[model samples]
Target chain A: DTAVSQTPKYLVTQMGNDKSIKCEQNLGHDTMYWYKQDSKKFLKIMFSYNNKELIINETVPNRFSPKSPDKAHLNLHINSLELGDSAVYFCASSQDVWGVSSYNSPLHFGNGTRLTVT
Target chain B: SQQGEEDPQALSIQEGENATMNCSYKTSINNLQWYRQNSGRGLVHLILIRSNEREKHSGRLRVTLDTSKKSSSLLITASRAADTASYFCATDHLYGNKLVFGAGTILRVKS
Candidate 1:
């Protein structure tokens, strides 16, 4: 079974349109994250949720909103998508390990959602 | 801003050769991890080296961490065509819960 899964593997829409990408995890992890990979292949963290609570919010624009309905689900919705929004969005989950030795927790990622804004 | 930056954005090697990629971070870290992402697949964790540990090995993969230099390296021995993928280095900061990833190194192993 896939540990982390994201829906809408491919998305192509016109600029100014709205879109949503859904992500779900079954690894029983308490922490989930959203990462965006640009054309340059620079992977950057966009947001993170721990047990349905928003934990980390990067400098992403307000047009990108992340909603976590539960501990296992985190969805990303983009309003008024722009041409610069064309990129692959990845969803990942990991155990909520904090403090010392927190880096040992390996992240499980989804295949990713490829979004294209024409 | 990205905390980690990988050297040699792209690399090409023949089958049976070894490939090495290096990463340098700006801040102190609890651990540094190496991940592999196949063409259209998600990133898979390959190895993790703690700040206190200098070297770690898993199968054909070897990882080394230098906290004093804030850098890490991932080496794959006897690489295969199937090993062609993008390798990324992620750092877990001492003050944050997120993993800051590098730009990635694209490795092409020609069989």
Candidate 2:
């Protein structure tokens, strides 16, 4: 079973279009996060949800929104996608907020969703 | 904006050699973690060292953290071709639930 999984590993859409990426975690984690990896391979945190509550919201554009239906699922919706949004979107989960578990408390990431805006 | 920055954007080494990667970050962190990504695949967590701990090891991977210097290093002994991948260091700040990642280091192990 996958610890964290995302749907539509690859997505291609025209500009001004809307898209959504779904994520689920089976590891029974309390905190889930969304990250964006740019062409430079720099990973940045976009949003974090703890038990369905928004905890961390970075400087990402308002066009991107994260919705957590439950502790096990977190979905990202982008409105009027732009060319700059073409990057790999990753979903990750951690057992606790501070990662107090040490070595075994690392985040579990899903295979990223590669989004392309034409 | 507590981002970890990894040095040597890319590295190349022959098989059976040792590979070492370094990461430095700004601000205090609760823990530092290292991850490996195989091409387009998802990142796999390699190791994590807490602020209270100085060193840790798993298999062929060794991680050392220097909280005073806000730096950490990952060393892989007896590197093999299969170990070719992108390595990233992430830091969890003391106040947040997010992990800020660094610009990864792409390691290439030639046979």
Q: DockQ of all candidates, in order? A: 0.73, 0.61
Question: How many clashes does the backbone of model 2 have?
Answer: 0
Error of 1 at A11 (Å): 0.3
Q: Local distance difference test, per candidate? A: 0.92, 0.92
By summed lDDT, the worst window of 10 consecutive residues in model 2 chain A runs over A97-106
Per-residue error for A99 in candidate 1, Å, reads 4.7
Supply candidate 1's per-residue lDDT for B84: 98
Candidate 1 per-residue lDDT, tens place, B1-111, comes to 537999889999999999999999998888899999998788999998888999999999999999998899999999999999999999988887678899999999999
Clashing pairs in 2: none
Interface RMSD for each predicted structure: 1.7, 2.7
TM-score of 1: 0.96
